[model samples]
Target chain A: MAEHAPSAKRIQSETDALIAPGHTLASITEKIASLALKRRTPLGWFVGFGISFLLLQALLYTLAVLLFKGVGVWGINVPVGWGFDIINLVWWIGIGHAGTLISAILLLLRQDWRTSINRFAEAMTLFAVACAVIFPVFHTGRPWLAAYWLFPYPNTMGLWPNFRSPLIWDVFAISTYGTVSALFWYVGLIPDMATLRDRAKSKAWKIVYGMAAMGWRGSARHWHNYESAYLLLAGLATPLVISVHTVVSLDFAAGVIPGWHATIFPPYFVAGAIYAGFAMVLTLSIPLRKAYGLEDFITMKHLENMAKVMLATGLIVAYGYTMEAFMAWYSGNPYEKFMMANRMGGPYAVFYWLLILCNVLAPNLLWIKNLRTNTTFLFLISLVVGVGMWLERFVIIPVSLHRDFLPSSWGSYAGTRYDWSAFLGTIGLFLTLFFLFIRFMPVISIFEMRTILPEGEGGEPKS
Target chain B: MRRRGTGTPDIHGVMAEFNTPHDVVEAAHRVHAQGYRKVDAYSPYPIEELSHALGFHHSPLPLLVLLGGIFGLVAVYGLQYWSAVIEYPMNIGGRPLHSWPAFVVPTFDGTILFASLTAVLGVLALNGLPEPYHPVFNVPTFALASRDKFFLCIEARDPKFDRDKTRDLLRALPGVVDVVEVEH
Candidate 1:
């Protein structure tokens, strides 16, 4: 035991309290669990939740109206068939990608820095995916049938979904991604729920947490199985993080539409997803860490690292934009060339430039190390980047669709009040779900955090 | 409301509380070396080397996920092949019935769908999990295992089972606070 003391000291200095220094494993458990157990919902949470709820209500109303009338309520016209619904769908799905990359990919790489934020990122993935799925469903104007129609089930009417269609691929891809993300999140939550169970004083808390914990006693044998399963899930999720988005990109690339027919959509879309995902992480995290007084847990280094990821992925997205333009010019295809011109100085030119500013120029600021480390700057930049990525989807979808090969069919489009409400409503949906999640569950991984403590690793205590 | 009982006071194991993670890990190693096979150590968090000392290596989860993915690929591709070519042939955009390139996306999706299911279900089945009732919860101080305490439980089912001898062995371990019998 004494011999391992040396190694214990080394581990302490190496992993240093990801939470506050001088905090024990007991303290970490207490602080995190108390946030839920004590029922001390902060004022910020109340304000945030209220705003989210109101917006969500507005969205639901808009959806109800859309269902009552038809797709005509949205600004979906002859040429620009896809509008805010499709654009918003792609945007939210892209936002969901970062969480998977952080939770699964970073775990496989053995990056311990991810431990602090991975839990929430996974929660973000599920919520964002939930928001993303709402679009394609209701966009059909007959969601009940669209949902059942997508599945290849036995029916009296011998009709089948077109196997070659990318939309069908999307149904499987998004649903699979959603289910896997949820399972992964819940599996990780079990041990942490046990912590909450044990510390809970009230009978109601005990029953709730205990059931969620599922008698997780942290037995070494259970841990062995848990670790192995977690790793397997991570390996399983890595490809999904790429493939789901690739299949999504295929939705556009598979299209015969001139601007969307490019081969680069897959990699470009994947990279853009990561870029936007990281920004969303930062956008949510910056305000959150401040509000929750979780600076010690989330840390400045985490923010900087996330910013660096945004910068790297942002550049890939920029390259994607550049190639889309160059290919349009190089191919000498009039429709493709016109698509580029339409994006640059056409009806939606303001959105295109804003996209360039937010996605391209905003990330360039991360080159300055100071800016990356600055939470305020990182937060604003991330928000800008998030906006830019959404606009990027808008530019790609409507601009291309508004003007096809035939000049007679060419027409610009705008989403109606319903479109804006639905889009705004999802923000409410995403935030509402997130706020509730933070209030109930351990926002950070209580069990995983202990590994960073000196005592768990047999490292010498630094202090 | 009171918790449910198993109706028999059958003793499950002898559990010893260890003050430090290092202490219990050392105890685990000694117990394993002394030829006690049904041994388990519980701690507030995962201790990497502790499980190795108890002789647990390799889970069959990866193999399960792989098999699931393989089956999914076959099933999905085959379903499409049969549906379009054999059952209900309908031509759209002049494409062939067995369009393998287009089928790749859905097949890829099916692989993920099945593989993820296998990962979750295989993990639960392998772990004997979602089990809210276990004898370990019978220990009075066992709740501490999720907080700051470390514990080692030696089951009565172990090959070398002797109540007095095991209690004596746990007591002799360094930094052990207490030892108590657990009932199922």
Candidate 2:
């Protein structure tokens, strides 16, 4: 076996260095599993969880008010029917795209850097989907009815969800995306869960971990099937991720409204989804690595690679913004031209310009090598991109809807307190779930981490 | 739990522990060459070579996933066709009842959903997992199999099994850390 050096200097190259040098398979397991198995809960976790829990309560309260008072409590009004609800729905779902991208797409590309981050990113995908589901459900005013109504269930009313409608397509896409992501995450966790089951000191934890482990014993036969299954999932998820956002964009593209109707929406929306998702991943990973003292696993290389993706996708989004304007003029349709003019200089002009600044200008700073590698700068930029993506959705939805072909129908829309409450509450819900996940589950995949170790590659050990 | 009425304890297998993946793979190759058909190896992560060493090259998981995806495509498309044309046909915007372009999105989703579900569930079913009381776990040191250590267990059910000889053969393998009997 190689000498287990604790103080070895990490390799400097970005491509070659994924995990820091000198980590043994055992050390990797100990480092990752110990976080969940540790007896003492960290104080920072309590503070973070407490704040998010409070926000979650606010979410529940907002839901209660909306359920009782109706969707009228939100800012939905004439000419601007979709308000924060749709904007947030799009934003949250878009944010989830990065998780799938990292887990599935990167794996297919044979990017070993994905190994350390895929587990938590998949978890993020699930949580973001969870947050995304709440908006459309409650936006209907009667979630109880909307629940059954959304599906093609046999009913005495003899009604079925319109197979042709983009909204119904959304029902299938988002639900399938959420379910597959969950299965992928759980399937990946089983072996690590077995590790935890074996490592748990307490009987209660042992049983809990044992059951979740599903009796995984790291058997060679199991690994054979598991690897094939995981690879096939990655294959399936690649197109599914692209299809999900495409269906989401069709929610607008399929509409006859000026700004909402564009063929560019599908690829544009998919790129923007990936762009936004990577930003959120950066937002979560930076603090997470710091808090857990996990600098070795989630190296600077990972952050730099993510920044490059953001830059590339950010440029694509910029192109998207440019195309929307050019097409508005090129199409020579009065409604399309008017929609573009209204977005740039009208009521919600501030949001449009700010989005340009955040999404276009902010990500351009990543062209600088130092800035991309800087953790603090990357985190701040990720936050900016997040806000920018939300603004992009905001500009697309209500801004475009507020003004149409007729001046008489023109009206502005704004979110009431309930709107803000619900939006922020979902953030709380996302963070709350995230905090619990980090607390209970392995933030990194222990088994996957082991694979990248020096001796993990099956060969004769160097003498 | 122990078997009743037998003076001798029920033996599951003899397991050899190794420190590195290479050692385990090498040991497994030697064991297989010795005509041990019911041998299995455990490691912290998937090693393609290790599986090949154990003579496990093909997995039925991909075929199952393909079947699952096909089922999803056919089933979802049929449901849409039946619902739209046969059950409750509504002419919205003069579009035909069989709007295949519109049906594509849901069909794609169902294909992925079913394929992914099958991949996960099928792998679990194939592995004979959720057997919490596996005989391998009877060995206390076996816990390290999920961490750093590598283990190769030749089951007693293998026709060529001779406890003392198997233990001696495993001990003779290069880099073998320890050899122990696994109890059922």
Candidate 3:
């Protein structure tokens, strides 16, 4: 039994080494908390933030022009009424899904590796949702009127938003998603805030963190309730995350458009959202781990696990594409067949093929063990997958809307300068928020990481 | 009852700091067994065993979340049904006014939103948080409680608490690093 014990410990250490060996609880806290506490501001942060800020200015400029010139500032018309606005909206929302999946779903599953990334990923989720809301709100033209009318508030006009409309459902899903995510993120931050408060060198810093900590004393009584509340939030967020994307997909699926009317939209869109989300996570984390020298905490095992998720979700997305093509021909619907044919061989065929290459073919490279562990390769693939997912939304929205049932109504759509600016601006907004978050908050959850220590388990440190 | 000083009790608790979670859990069990009812354990991260040692059997947060979810479902569904079928009705393609299928998404959202909000607020309320001040923070070494230290605090309010005796008992614990009195 004693000999077997050593081998068992060896296997566990090899397979499930979440944190590096030899880290005591104090070292873990100091390493993570010090990034936001003791570490001097890096020069790269300023350069990156400066570029993102300039892009944010572009986004603000675009919004100003859009408000002044009406909806015509973009390339929306009769047939392609949903252009860059809806495309970018879907793309950004899909990217936010990975964060929820990591923080909520993975936590529920007890994936210990999720601890190091969940904090920053949840931050990413909030920022991504922030970027997403801008497109649809601005696209409504009179956003003030839209805000007033879209909600079911008692008003002098005596009108209610159409409950039957998927647009109304979108409003509910997105707002709830934002609210719940904020709650979850803040709840997770409480203990870490306490840690920061205790560790801060200056009085002002202590007060700032102390207020955020809310006088968390880490009492057993409080941990009892905090654990329950956190678990419940995770349980609630799992379904909410799935529902948000499903509702977003329903915005198109509920319509009668040949390409958009499929019953598979919910699952397909959900899978694609996760795929895009993991891609975005990898894209951010690779650079983050490099910049901050967090290789000890955010280990290669974490990266490999994420890559495997991307591959699996990528395969699911590939299956969705195949099913769409198969059903188009199998159902013998001329419109569906035409939609598939047009997607594959029409004027926008390049985008369709490019998406297949990026989303499907590129991620397949991760199946190789050597490439999966290679940071540079993983980083490049993540960026490719991000672009591919954006193109998938573009292909689904505008490409499907361009050619209508009637030959006379057939037309083409292209994004104007405003459309380009709005899309790029959101990226700026996402990065800007992320930069501030990493600077001000513990990017990796400090307390949660402490729990992963071998000492936390009431056992001797292995190896 | 033995009195230490001739004034209102200025000490909050007798705090003993330990280096490891195992030591804290062991100390908590011993402290609790000695008939101290107002005992609490503090650590940088939650140790499930320590909570059990400190006699925390259950938390009411889950029930609050469940109730909040049910309330959200009923309220949102009622609003949707009332608006669509009663107050304002419009015939779009002659579809039914009570479109329950279409209402599912929003209802789900409402339930999750309300439940999550309740979970966070309920836990905070139950724990009496946003306190910004507590007697536990009065101990200088208590700062290490959020770093690497594990603490077993026997409050002055405890029936079995004797300042000198409790301090002596804490000092004798197997893995205790230091013992101090937390001020009120």
Candidate 4:
């Protein structure tokens, strides 16, 4: 027997004691099973999953009706050709931003604590992308013809997708973003799966986990391969995280839309995506830690770190808004100035205020150390920020389009019941996918977290 | 030294426990000096020096992803050009016969597709996915890997592995216990 070294003690208390060295599979399994049974399904998880499913169903029905009938089911008219659908598309895509940011950007910065939440965040990125993709495909008014958007296929229509068009850029960016994210998420799962595999007692469970682990022997060679691949993917994803949102923003920027035509759209959109993404991470993580018994693993320090990132991005988003206002005033274009005014002072003033409050003001609470570290307060603020970000998108899209050029063409567009239903349904879809993910997979990267633990003072990774 | 019924060595591999990373690095250096080639090191997190000490090699994943992305760019551009320019050249807005700029979206999309494909394929290939079995699960205590235990396997299959010598070598190192040979 190896001499027991008390070096790796995870001591929360003397009485509770550190985890015993070489704790048996039986004991771990028994603990997990007991925890699973003892712990109540978190209310947030219930609400998030339940509502997301319901909303998903409504979205499906709306899509069915839209597909069978036409895009007329949407409130899109001539000038406002992109109504709820585009807004949802942009919003969902924006929501996905935080996932990539958490998984990739933080990874590059050598922020090991990111491991605790990166897996789930990455999953969220994929699902949010799945949700985002639904809108653009349906928005085409002919979902079957989405392949047409892929290229100027050798069809009767002579138009290859206009490279000159940002919409086409979007199809590329979004699809790529979703695909790469999903890959990253799944690949990241392997080591953790091996952990689960090694931990499984039943032969059936063993087989299932064994297959997922993909014969991981924890060979130094394998680890080397795995680490390099992961780093490369992270590198690839870093650019993608920025580029995808930047391109998405260009969908508006490349056009003649006054407020959208600014040079700052790329960085601005990226910042907003990260802001929304961080808000979402908080929204999900706060409750998950309680539900999954991962508080120790995903410590308050982690939350504070995330909140700081959120606050920084929030400031950036606020700056972007300021720039837009300043640019509108400075550009001396009536339409540009008018669009800027419409965003802040027009009929969509409420939405604008909500956006500012949620994205800008709410995160400022993090400035206070106590507020940032308080899990419950952090969670509530996260939810507020999440809602605020959605409104931010709402204000950015329809509000801008609602009163475009001609006042005669301008009629205030309010979201119909269908729009609200679809939005809620999308939420349901996101939660349902999330719930399933948590139930099956270890939400934290067990392997990565071990690496992040302080070898000594200062939680610096042993490496 | 013992041999199991399966004709494999009955050594259960060395288990080195360390309090801090520096200790592990020092221990690795000592183990290396002892000329044990089959030994491995496990830690809670990756230690770059330890990885080097353990003789880690570079992964081929970056090249794979790069190629995948390049392929995507080419395929998407080619498809768009073939479909629009060569197959059905319909002039809109007095555009040129072959519009390269117009192909950027699809080309860009294809690049993403390729990159994503690489990621998935790279992961699958690197991890040896869909593998239904392995020998590590045979060790019951191995499950502690997730929570606390860091282990090293000096597999019997390694060319330098001599059950008696490897076990003797590992047993000599501080913090090492139960140097059992792992069988596949």
Candidate 5:
């Protein structure tokens, strides 16, 4: 609340509003819910959605080709046996971390600014996780069996998944992460769903939202239970956000490769995940808050806080890179030294420098408070960070794998046409899902917004 | 919970609207003090301390999750041991069959999985949710409970069931907008 504290007379004079000026709780529901119910589709939404849909179709096409031609359609042959598929899997999974950080971690830390963005961010987490799992399953070449084989169910074949393998651990980590994130997201949506149910204009939408709300009556008893459950979920989810990416990094580090075998990976991966995740959040929120005219809810204060997080996490990621280089030299091992030298000056040198530029240099702009507060600058910088994070994965995976212990075994690799399609297509799929989410659900948690209003104003912002 | 008879106009309670969450908390305290046992307060968001004032002071969620997490830790760790060590074993790098060190990651994951699921199910079951309908929704303006308003519903089943006295009690509260009959 931005309200000036009252004197003994208790005049209810307003200070600056936290949400858009003059929008009461009633109008908040009307404004957000109407976008769905009224179905006044914006041209920008169509243009964005159309492109994403096309990319999604392209992804599907590539999948069909992959299924038909087998893993041969990709560039992972012999030495470079983990190409764009693994890169994408790591990328999407890393992207999912930001949502959990916002919704669960920030909630535990009592950061209320997250209320404006947490709902959609959790939705982003779910979608990104959804995009992520597609790669590993399809990469297995037989997804149907890989799906069941990945789990440890008793079978007539008399086999179980290798529990020692990080790949198997990844199956557990990602699936559990997905389940918890989904439940957390849905639990938070209940009261707001009830709000939508009540405010719905049409009978169909009312019933749809009614079922989604699960008869939430806003009772003190219900909120008490709901709040407790939410807090518990947050506590439970906090560890998963760190653990999922740590386990992902283990997939690389557990291997015998010199560059991959490092003690710094777990925390390093976690830091990089947060760095990329915050960047993506900024990328989505800057445009979203502006277009929806939710400038007050997703205030400049909120934007600046996110930039600060990105800066801090980005620096940690940069430190991880430095340590990785230092450790390679400090070890005094030829293979390790070669791996470090290769990363710096090998054929992938262009990508390595680009990664530095995007991940390290671009986020440096946020050090100046003005650049971070500038929406266009933040958007572009965030995009650079997103690309930088991708390149970081590329350098870690394909570049490292392209040449290994034996000179005879060394072979350079490039992603085929199908590989690019799969990667880009998932991006499209992510955006498409995001568009539907923004159009249908309350992107900002409506009920939570009420709590932020100043006292005695009756949930109404003054004009 | 105790539905008095059937059909519409079957009076559930006298529902009153409060201007802000604070006023609702104050009215709830006053009503609870007035020996109204079958009272419930509704707000657009959780009002801190309001639940305790309205006599919903305890929740079993944390305990349920704790127990669930312990059970999950043991169950998942044991399952991995049995699968890798006892049921079928392979000599990959000639490591130990139990591989208890390798079990930690999945065990941590399983604990989270079970704990979170328990929280969701426990909440739903305790709240008696997936309830397609509620009597509160029958109160037409009760929709405002999800928006700007806070409501205090005094069920007719309470011993002090004088409709006029209850209405007067609510109307006397500061910042109360209206008191209306809520029927199922």
Candidate 6:
């Protein structure tokens, strides 16, 4: 059977090709497994885990104190009822948007490069949404009965959650963002789970993977259904991601507070999401590429492409800043002009400057290819951008609302220890989740990788 | 012209393997014309034309999920309205009854939650999940399914299944093998 012999030989060659040279899946699996197992130890993951645990503990203590002591434990006063809590809520919600932008929007665009980062990004979206939902739901004076917001009673107590309230809008935006993101992430994981299922050496691993794969047989019929479902989900998620961020902006836009009532908020917020998202991607990807040695998969080309997007969005955000300034002056609204003037020339001007430095100035370094390719430089810049974006949200929310329509109601705002610690706690939670995700999955879609084979069939660019 | 390997009298069906999905669909048409009504084909990738040859019907999953999501939205909105404005109207900012804009966020979230839940649940229920074990695992080389191997099972569960006739029919085709019954 010459035919049989050649086919047999071909099969062997194919197997060899898959696991050969620097591309051995076994070696990759071993490296990841070793990292994961080590990371489980108190010593290995101590820095991340301990930090997260401590932050969470501090947050719990602070929240308990706040709940027990009432909302007065913080600096929020008459006019600025929505202070650091809402600021942090919007900030976290904004952070959550980036993940879906990478996972859903990039997937729809057919950008294969998104595979390396989408899983972690999607997870980030979920965690960020978790962090977001916390502030709004619990920041209320009576978190114990936050359920009262949802009930439609006919009583004369007059305690109905204002349907016109942007706070109500946020509840919808953040929750929908979280739910849809979770679905998209899980569906994306199924094929990968099947891969793990087929490759596992241990019986326990096999069973775990098998259950997660949901009996994926790699049937043609199943693939058809899977692809269709994915396309449909992508269609839903892309617009949903955009809508979520736009609605988050509306929280400020809907208000009559001088700096908050801007018509340019929707686009501005979206641009900021992409900017912050790309910044975070750079932050994570730089470290990840070096640690996991994924230079080939998450190449400089991908980084550069993302950097260009960052530069564009950064400029747009700068424009939005300029527009807000111009609109204040042009509209001839005395209060609006005074609010914009105060933001630039008043007590919290340091935050405004930091936002400018981090968001506008930091990303300008991307123009230099040497800086873009230098992982260390990219990491530093990313950290700056990330910090800047958070500050941007802080300045937008607290400063704007701290003194709104009437200077009579104006008050100098300051975040308490609880505010600072809760924010730090969220950072810990985000890092812990990110680290765990990188350890388990390939961090890159293995199937999607195959499609990118430079010399393989169907390798040509799609028209 | 039946084979005796399966040790059964009535079983007969042809099996064939093709390198590309295009070849597989072309072969399916030929097999169907040769009166092999019981024949089936499989490939590593989906071949659209083959579905037509196999006469597959429409799936109701999308419609089911959409309807489930709509029901969830109605239920969530109705309950929220009942509780906030109807049962306990605690006025804070002097907002009126039937405050629909404020209801928009929770209603939207509930609708999405319902839709997503339905999609996930529908997929799992339709697929009959928690399938910890399967006979395919017993076929030592079946792991190749994840890679390049293509396979089809004309199960004994099928009405036309016959061991001998299936083997004879399979022999007439190229690269066919075993013709074994998939015992559950």
Q: Which structure among the candidates has the greatest DockQ?
A: 2
Residue A22 displacement in candidate 6 (angstroms): 8.6
Question: What DockQ, on C-alphas, does every prediction get?
Answer: 0.59, 0.72, 0.68, 0.34, 0.64, 0.33
Which is superior by DockQ, 4 or 6? 4
What TM-score does model 5 achieve against the real structure?
A: 0.94
Model 6 Cα lDDT, one tens digit per residue, A1-463 = 8699998986655432322224433333344334433334445445766677676777777778888888777667776677778777767777777788887788889877676567667777887787777777667868757765634344455565545567666766777778788888888777667767777777887777778788876554555455556666676677777878888898789878888889999999988887887787777778777766666556666777777778888899999988999999999999888888888888899999888898888888889887876778878887888888888887887788777566687777888877787677667667776766766655666544543443224121222
| Candidate 3 residue A370 C-alpha distance from true site, Å | 1.0
For residues A1-463, could you state the per-residue lDDT of candidate 2 as single tens digits?
1443422422345334787766777778999999999999999999999999999999999999999989999999898999999999999999999999999999999998998889889999999999999999899999879855589889888988789999999999999999999998998899999999999999999999999999999999989999898889899989999999999999999999999899999999999999999999999999999999988899998999999999999999999999999999999998899889988999789999999999999999999998998999999999999999999999999998988668899898999999999999999999999999999999999888887666544322443
- What is the iRMS for every candidate structure? 2.2, 1.8, 1.9, 4.3, 2.2, 4.5
| Model 3 per-residue lDDT tens digits across residues A277-323 | 99999999999999888988998889999999999999999999999
User: Can you give the lDDT of residue B73 in candidate 4?
Assistant: 82
Over B1-184, each residue of candidate 5 has an lDDT whose tens digit, in order, gives 5544222234778889877777888898899999888899998888766887888767988999999999899999989999888888888889998888899999999999999999999999889999986677777788888877889998877877567788899889988998988776
How are the candidates ranked when ordered by TM-score, highest leading?
A: 2, 3, 5, 1, 4, 6
Q: Point out where model 6 deviates above 4 Å.
A: A1-47, A150-161, A451-463, B1-59, B65-111, B164-181
| Model 5 score (lDDT) | 0.87
Regions of model 5 farther than 4 Å from truth: A1-23, A459-463, B1-10
lDDT of 1 by residue, B74-171 (tens): 99998888888898898887888878898988888788888888888887787787896988888878888888889999887775767788889998
Q: DockQ order of candidates, best first? A: 2, 3, 5, 1, 4, 6
Q: Write the per-residue lDDT of candidate 5 for residues A279-391, one digit (tens) a residue.
A: 88999999898888877678777788889999999999999999999999988999999999999999999999999999888888889977877889988988899999999
- Per-residue CA lDDT of candidate 4, range A1-463, in tens? 2333443333323212222233332333334433323335657667767766776789788778778878787787767777888888888888899998889888999876687788889988988998888888877877677786554455666445555567777877887788788878877887777767666667887777777777766655567667777787888888788889888888888777666677998898888888878888888888777876766566666788888888898899889888888988988999988888778788779888878887777778789987877888988988888788778777777788778587788876766666677777778788888887886677766666555433443122443
Q: By the lDDT metric, which is better: model 2 or model 5?
A: 2
Look at candidate 5 and give me any clashing residue pairs. none
Q: Which window of 10 residues has the lowest lDDT sum in candidate 3 chain A? A: A454-463
lDDT (Cα, 0-100) at B31 in candidate 4: 68
Query: Quick one: how many clashes does candidate 2 have?
Result: 0
Of 3 and 5, the candidate ahead on DockQ is 3
- lDDT of model 1, residue A134: 92
